[model samples]
Target: MSTPTSTTAWVHKTTIKPTEKFIETLQKQDLPLPTLGPKDVLVRLHAASFNYRDILIPRDQYPFPVNWPLVPMSDGAGEIVAVGPQVKSFAAGDNVMTVFNQEHQAGRHSIVSATSGLGGALHGVLREYAVFPEYGVMKSPKGWTHEQAATLPCAAVTAWNALKDIKAGQSVLVQGTGGVSLFALQFAKAMGAFVVATTSSKAKEEQVKALGADVVINYNETPKWGEVAKKASPRGEGIDVVVEIGGTATLQESFRAVRMEGTIAIIGYRAGPTKDGEKEPGWGEILGSICQMRAIFVGSRAIAEEMVSAIEVAGLKPVVDPKTWTFDEAPQALDWFEQGRHVGKVVIKI
Candidate 1:
């Protein structure tokens, strides 16, 4: 792990260059120590994780919003080193995570802005230190490490928002063992909902089952995983919630599997629909016509607060493994995430 020097560190940072020459052009440049804003908290970062969005930024293909020469990541966890005078919710030494949308602190719909997000239009937390507004920070649950807490803001919170209204004894179907799906399974089980999970790899079937999934469907073995998911739910009652991470690849099947009025949280496009002979509908047609309601992104800060409370109340712990990499190994960590070998969240220790 990289250590801090002089209460500050020589941080190796990543940035985007418009030349499109090579990603290496965004090299390990030195950044001056990060400073706290009046209502901001300066966090001494221990670890940060990569999301699909992080991978897309370097390739110049990310769909959301961004700017160049930006440090690239939205999720991170660390101890609070200093808090501005007006901050009272958290103090120095508290382990906390910064919000995905820095500007939108509360409510159901977030007001998206270019300057608020990390790793795109604004500076991200790939460095040894990061400063965030106190309103965007949340104290991590007791007994969770910085690495584990780092995975919550993006994928995990999206899962929580997706199933927030689900009731006890209801059923949920998760697409695969990716970050959002796996987190959904654990959370849903703890909510007293029966879970049906799927995986292309047989090796991960038992692993999903052990995570409290009532049924694990090996999609490789059964091509129609939607049918399997239906059968697994009691009396073919169908799923009340579906954590839809496969995007176009599983959208049609998701439509078939979910009960009428059930909700699907569409989170990713990694597993595209055209692959494996799955048919994909045009987004314009599907958006207004097929699904009655759709949630495009994670909920607001108020939702994040509710999720933290539910997590504590249910004693739900996020599953994360530290993916430590020396300053030189950052590229390899990104490559591994691109290869999709991880069962849980992947983090880089700086």
Candidate 2:
């Protein structure tokens, strides 16, 4: 394959206020492709998926400072077009997906590996072509589309990590109907765990049930939905695991819903953006609940590989939103995601 001199990329030039349009801060420009390193492979990205964190970056809501003119988005899959001298794991024409953190290969995660994430500390794969270290990309699952594979790195991996230890007959409670939550529902059911899902919209209840949720709680109607979830557990003991995405605003409920010695994986902060001059809610009853609460970043490359194998074995297909978008329609896709109407992962085909 011939290497191209330049490629198109969407660059976030500046941070914007919450009320402002995110697309206003972005500019598409033709950039000269960087020289490949000894262990680098150039990928022609075919598709990319959006995450909640991607929206937060341009709004200055993310913890990290803006890497100006940054290419945004961490999850993508494509075909490799070129490989450098020492690249042996992959070759030209292989389909591959990006790992969220380039340095997190296996075992425990640390500050170093955490800082090596794409789309924030490093350049992301929101462009037509991207250069990645040989270890930074993994072969996509067999018989999956690039768009489907693009959804795996962040949301799917986070769900996999959260439920990896779950056993048959255990109970899992998931909040909302976002990418991670839906993935959690699918994985929990595949693992033979009874799944209890919560959503604010009554209209989405059926969709949740179709995804294998044993019970669906409308948090809107039942404000204390956590207690309801606990009571719904077998023998009314409480949920074995809670996929808690709402931080300060919803942790109290998670504490209420989780049983003694249950596990709560704090994966996201959909309920954050705390009010001005107000600290996050105190630990309150969390300590008394006697549950294990851990924060979940996206998992390692090894975990992703393991997840792919499991997905292949089970023939699990990720539930992507029906609405498809062209690469130029990224702004529209972001707007659709921010509105919070989509029931599953959103994708943009390049």
Candidate 1 per-residue lDDT over residues 175-286, each given as its tens digit: 7777788889988888899898888887788789889889888878886777667667876856778788777777776766676667777777777546764467567645
TM-score, predicted candidate 2 vs. hidden true structure: 0.96
Pairs that clash in candidate 1: 249-273
Q: Looking at candidate 2, what is the lDDT of residue 92?
A: 94
- Model 1: lDDT equals 0.74
Each candidate structure's TM-score, on Cα atoms with residue i matched to residue i, is 0.87, 0.96
Clashes (N, CA, C under 3 Å) per candidate:
1, 0
